[model samples]
Each structure stands twice: as structure tokens, then as C-alpha cells.
Target: MTSLMALVVGVLYAAAIYMMLRRSIVKLVIGLVLLSNAANLLIFTAAGLRRDAPPLVPDDAQVPAGLVADPLAQALILTAIVIGFGVLAFAVVLIRRAYEVVEADDMHQMRDTDT
Candidate 1:
């Protein structure tokens, strides 16, 4: 499982980097999303893939140690995902506004002014 996760992370990183190099706003957005997923996967991988149950302790019962997944990683990943989604949304909006203001649809042209 760990190896599979590593492989997925590698592929995701590669795809994200390649897309980011392209001169299309849409592609850049996709790349950013993929990169975020890759980062989240990385965090999960680092948290140890133990088959731990939820950290909920039943009343009048004591669960043994080492039986709960690392909550910190889960929280971190969730926060990163939300932040990445917000960034992606903002980037898309910015791209659309740029296209409308400049009457341009290509990235290369956007890099230059209409002067």
C-alpha cells in the first residue's frame, strides 16, 4: 500500500509540473489541483499506514494505545485541501477577469501589454 501511494504521488507530481509549464490557464489550474492532491498524499504517507481505528474512546471502556490513527495529519491535510481549493477558485476567477479585460485568450499574449 505504501509503495502504491508513493507511486501515485510521483505520478501526480510529474503531471502537475508538466501541466504547470504549459501556456494555458486551464492547464495551470489543473496542475495546481494535482499538486495539492500530491501534497495531501505525501502527508498521509508520512503519517504511517497503520490500521488504526478512530480515536473515539467509548464510555466505561478503555481502548488500547496505538489503536488510533494520527489525528494531526488528518487535520493538516484537511486544512491544506480547503486552502488549495480556495486558491484554485481564486486563480480561475482571476484568469477569467484577465481574459475579459485584455480581450486575450492565450497566456503568451497575456504576458505582454496591448501597447
Candidate 2:
């Protein structure tokens, strides 16, 4: 499962880079979203996959009875997801404003307008 997830992450990263290299601003946003997702998956995979219970312990026990999921990875992924959403939202707004100002979605055209 870890290997599979690693492969998936690799594919997502590759796709993200490909999309980011495109000339369209929309594609760049899509690439950013993909890149964020890949990072989250990488963190998850690094944390290890296990058929374990939640990271909880009985009142009398000093530790969990058996294998337990890593809470830190979950927290990190959750934080990353929220941050990614905010970044995506900001990018969308920025793109919209840029389009309004330059009347172009192509990065090349927008750059040309600077002259």
C-alpha cells in the first residue's frame, strides 16, 4: 500500500508540474491544487499505513493497546488541506483581477501587456 501511494504521489507531482508549465493561468491554479494534494499524500505515506485503531488509550492503560494511527500526520494533512484551500481561493481571486486588468488569461499575453 505504501508503494502504491508513493507511485500515486509521484504521478500527481509529475502531473502538477506539467500543468504548472502550461501557459494558461487556470492550469497553473490546477497545478497548485494537484501539488498540494501530492504533498498531503506524501506525508500520509511517510507516516506509514496500518490497519490500526484511532490514537486513543484506555483510561487505565499507559498507551494504546495495539497499533494506532499517527495523529501528527493527520493533523499536518488537515492543516495542509485548509492552507491549500486558502491559497487556491486567493489564486482564483488574483487571477480574476489580473484577467480584468489585462483582458487575457494567457501568461504570455499578460506579460506582453507590460510593455
Candidate 3:
């Protein structure tokens, strides 16, 4: 499962880079979204895959029994997801405004108007 996830993450990163290199502004946003997702997946994969009990302790126990999933990676991924969503929202709004002002979705066309 870890190997499969690693492969998936690699593919997502590759796709994100490809989309980001496109000339369309919309594709760039899509690529950004993809990139963020890939990062989250990478973090998850690095945390290890297991069907362990949740990281909880019994009232009498000082620590969780047996293997427990790490919470730090989950927290990090959650934070990243929220931040990524915010960034994506801002990027969408910025792209919309840019499109309205430049009247073009192509980066080349937008660049030509910089004069």
C-alpha cells in the first residue's frame, strides 16, 4: 500500500508540473491544486500505513497500547488542507480578475498587454 501511494503521489506531482507548464491560466490553478494534494499525500505516505488503534490512552494507562497511528502527520495534513483551500480560493479570484482586465486566458496574451 505504501508503494502504491508513493506511485500515486509521484504521478500526481508529475501531472501537476505538466499542467502548471501549460499556457492557460486555468490550467495553472488546476496544477496548483494538484500540487497541494500531492504534498498532502506525500505527508500521509511518510507517516506510514497501518490499521493500529487510535492514539488514545485508557484512564489507567500512561500511554496508548500497541501500535498507534501518529497524530502529528494527520494534524499537519489537516493544516495543509485548510491552507491549500485558502490559497486556491485566492488564486481563483485573482485569475478571474486578471481575466476580466486582460480579456485573455492565455498567459502569452496577458503578457503582451503588459506594455
List model 1 lDDT by residue over 13-86, tens digit each. 99999999998877888888899999999999988887878787777678745578888899999999999989
TM-score of each: 0.87, 0.92, 0.93
Distance (Å) between predicted and true CA of 53, model 2? 1.4
TM-score between model 2 and native: 0.92
Off by over 4 Å in 1: 61-66, 113-115
Candidate closer to the true structure by TM-score (higher is better), 1 or 3? 3
Instruction: Give the lDDT of residue 66 in candidate 2.
Output: 83
What overall lDDT, based on C-alpha atoms, would model 3 receive against the true structure?
0.95
Better of 2 and 3 by lDDT: 3
Please, what are the lDDT tens digits per residue for candidate 2 over residues 53-95? 9999999999989889999999999999999999899999999
RMSD of 2: 1.7
lDDT of each: 0.87, 0.93, 0.95
Error of 2 at 33 (Å): 0.3
Clashes of 2: 0
C-alpha RMSD values across all candidates: 2.4, 1.7, 1.6
Candidate number with greatest lDDT = 3
Top model number, TM-score = 3
- The residue-level lDDT of candidate 2 at 97 comes to 93
